[model samples]
Target: MKKWLLTTSAVVMMGSAIPIAWAGDGLWRHVPSTHAHSSARAVAGGPFAGHADVQHDWQLRSSVRVSRQVLREAYLASRAVYTEKLQKYAKVTPSQAKKAIAQAHPGMKVEDVQLRNIRTDLVYTGLAQDDEERYLVIVDAGNGKLLLDRLLPTHHERVFSGD
Candidate 1:
């Protein structure tokens, strides 16, 4: 009976420890990359020449942190692209940004406008008509601000081969 009781207690203790191990939830382990770029100066080296060890040595110390930073930058750039497209195509002015939003999206007001400035490699908003939603407008692609008109998305003119 004594041996059985000791065995049961040990099993019960081990089982209870499992839940405790899960408290970290693995979220901290994978901090995400965006967090690293919150402060641009936080990470050094060059446009993209820094070594992993160098970046890890900074305030952030994990791949997840670097990823979090990259994501945030991408989001910001996306917003900038949206705004720039609207302004260029729709001719939305800063003073008239609100008015354009109202006109483009009737009955529905602009909740918020985000700007994104992608890297030079990719097309600014894929070089299209630039308008995604009636409520949301791409004011200009150059500056990356929101606009007020019914901007169209990019329309690619395909080439016919061997006609």
Candidate 2:
């Protein structure tokens, strides 16, 4: 009986240890750390400054190795806050923002102009005509800056395909 009890206790201990080891090694391993400086690169916020149609240019090498217009009129949706002194900095009406974008591009259409409370800095996803079909432009709200414009990758279609 003594030997049996000792064996049973040993088995119980081993069983508990197994679960602990599994938890430490397999299940709960590799959690997302919130440390500031873990040397991890910051995740890119959706291809835009996330504010307005801020314009920026970047050079891209063509398949033939020649430089070409890779991006243009990238739009981002952002929240714009106008402090007490800068009333112009205050809130730009949606119509006002639309006019600004049109004046910049001259006959460019703004698509998906969603005004949310959080990203209210005048950043938005806009549609524009370029070399490709429809460019999802990242526009800056405050200054109507075109941050980036490019052909969206085909990978997005897969996500919408319902696999």
Candidate 3:
């Protein structure tokens, strides 16, 4: 009876310990890549070069499972393509960009303005202060023509917030 009691206690203790170990392991498990394009190169040597590392740290800190590859692509694209397009296409001053955003989102202040090159279109993405919305004002960089004005999805508030 004494031996059987000791064996049962050991089994119970081992079972409980397994779950604790599994839980710890689960925290560090590799997250699957989200982007379909696996050929995308890892970003290096630019203003946004360390973006992947920063994103990894943020993922670990927040316990979020965001794909590192997606972050790397964004940095690579922005540095390699978007920045150049902005300088070439954007004839308007930052204040003018802000004014355009304000006009669209009436009663809301423009918090930030960033130029983006989405495919072939050059756009000014403006953040609104009140609802944390992003307004995409498409502009022709070649001739300074305003193309499209629209609001992106609401969830992008987190993206614009830099969180």
Compute the lDDT of residue 99 as modeled in candidate 1: 46
Write down the TM-score for model 1.
0.23
lDDT per residue as tens, model 2, 14-93: 74576586454333344443554332322344223222322222233447432223111111101121122233443554
Residue pairs with backbone atoms closer than 3 Å in model 3 (clashes):
89-141
Between candidates 1 and 2, the one scoring higher on lDDT is 2
Model 3 Cα displacement at 131 (Å)? 4.9
Q: How close is candidate 2 to the true structure, as a TM-score?
A: 0.29
RMSD (CA, angstroms), candidate 1? 20.8
Q: Global CA lDDT of candidate 3, please?
A: 0.54
What is the lDDT, from 0 to 100, of the residue 143 in candidate 3? 49
Leading candidate by TM-score: 3
The CA lDDT at 43 in model 3 is 34
Native-structure RMSD, model 2: 25.0
Window of ten residues with lowest summed lDDT in model 2: 70-79
lDDT of each: 0.41, 0.45, 0.54
Evaluation by lDDT, superior candidate among 1 and 3: 3
